[model samples]
Target: MAAKQAERQLVEIFGHAPRDHSSAARTFWQLNACPFIGKECTKFDHTRTICYGTCSVTNAEQEVVICPNRLYENNYEAIRKVGSDVFGDIPFMLFNEYVRIVASGNHQMDCLVALGHNSGKEVKISQLSMDWVIAHIRNQQLVEYVGIEVQSIDITGNYRDAWYAARDMRDSIPASGHGLNWANVHKRLIPQIIRKSLVYSKSLLVKNGLHFIVPEPVYQRFEAIIGANIPLVDRPGKEVIVVHTYDIGPRVEQGRMRRLVLNRELMFDLNEFSKRFISGPNLPPGIALDDKIRSILAVS
Candidate 1:
């Protein structure tokens, strides 16, 4: 019963059918078959287009098409789920705790804030690319802003292509790789972490700092590749928390349907994280910089 509820939620969130192992295999095969496998080259242009499409498959009558990119869609849905889970709960953290939820998404970051305000007129500072933001209030006054950025392995072109390629190659004539090579963590996940962290680190309103949510495997890869070697920047007292997730498979319900669970036990404080991981590039001079500097100087 719980599994059924989870599946329903996942379907609502991802707009894809629930896929068991058998169904997934059939879908993979049908989507990867070439449209002109047995046809002569003279009858069809072999070089122009061979496979039906990477994401979907067409029927014999060509009247209907089936899309099998459930895994890809799952990754996207997972990101949004993580964002919703993290930001949606901020308002209920403490009884009578004044909290304002801002800039969340249904399946992606639609509004990475550009100067918004809460009902109480508290300033909400955010970048155009931030994933989500939450503001905390104390004594009827806004005290801190919390930013969140979510990334997935599917963001990398190589990983995405490899995933499809693996499916397509599984039963091809000249069978090659059977699985995704997987993109380098440094190349895919780290860059996003650095980019999002830099944006949050530079924000003047996010006093509580930013959180980056990623899959556990990606986080482990990041730790293995650059453990205890992160570089430092001048953004003192700023924090970039790294949250890793665990895939609890596709059987349970309530945030468990093909969803990744965040490991709250491990957090990477920027003050300490910067001591090892390399810092992102400095922000170029702009009006925002002037304002940030002024705020810092005033606080000091």
Candidate 2:
């Protein structure tokens, strides 16, 4: 059953289905690129390629190349590490687990995992919404759910320029910042953070919590924004967990590379607003509630 669901999602994203978890993961890796390591380029015919130039830390003498396979492996490893570092060995279930949990209750369901949306239209896969999800069941009924979003410092636009600048500066670049301010947090990262937050705060998806995994610099920038504009106390529908990370090294033997090291974690639970906050109907609009989900929210 889980295999079928996985295949279905794969077909939706790739136009072809995968047979198993390994195949699905491999397909996902092939379809996605590391936002920080290189720039994605498209040819006139619309063929896309990831371009990684010379070693950022070293001079132009040493050409730098990023292996998509390596980047994908590292990205998954980082996400798993963040989960363990923040939640501490808590057993995490895959999307199949979520499906099973919802099925067991015989309740109506409307949930999406690793799916992307843009202004109600299907967009490319959303890296921000692909973390993990858990459904809490009580008395054989679905009660609440939790979702997580992981973020890393990467350039979103003009990848080649940002990549070169970061290499020249030997530091991470922002999603959007002033001229040559590559290290200062880019403008795009903040919006991504807010959109993920709203998936819970404004949407009806996760009722209990929404976690965000980010580097220390990203966390500080996000916190600063929250402090200046939006106070946590005002929002009650969901909780936000910020996982902070640091850079490990540029140890140069053959070439220079860096790994993000996960460190401390902080959270803000909207316990006070959980019950009072407005929630969308149990299922998303236009999606039919079916018996596979127990039909708990089916309209009479």
lDDT (0 to 1) per candidate: 0.39, 0.37
lDDT of 1: 0.39
The stretch of ten residues in a row with the least summed lDDT in candidate 1 is 5-14
Residue-pair clashes, model 1: 5
Off by more than 4 A, model 2 = 1-50, 53-75, 81-144, 153-188, 201-208, 223-237, 250-252, 255-258, 269-300
* Per-residue lDDT of model 1, residues 1-300, tens digit only: 333311101111121122322443334334543221212221112465443233221122111112212222333343344334444533222111122332232222122221121112323245345544554444345555566554434321122333343434433222112222235456655665666666677777764455555544445556765563354343323564646354323334332224333443345566555444454233244788888988989963
> Hey, what RMSD does candidate 2 come out at?
19.2
Per-residue lDDT of candidate 2, residues 1-300 (tens digit): 343311101011111112212343333335442333223321112233443321112112211111212222243454445335434455443345456766788444433222111112222245644344444443445455555554543322234444334323334443312121224333565555455565666546454455655545445545444442222432323555343343333333222234434555455544322221223122233444354355675544
Please provide TM-scores, in order, for all candidate models, with all chains considered together.
0.41, 0.39
Model 2 global lDDT (CA atoms, 0 to 1): 0.37
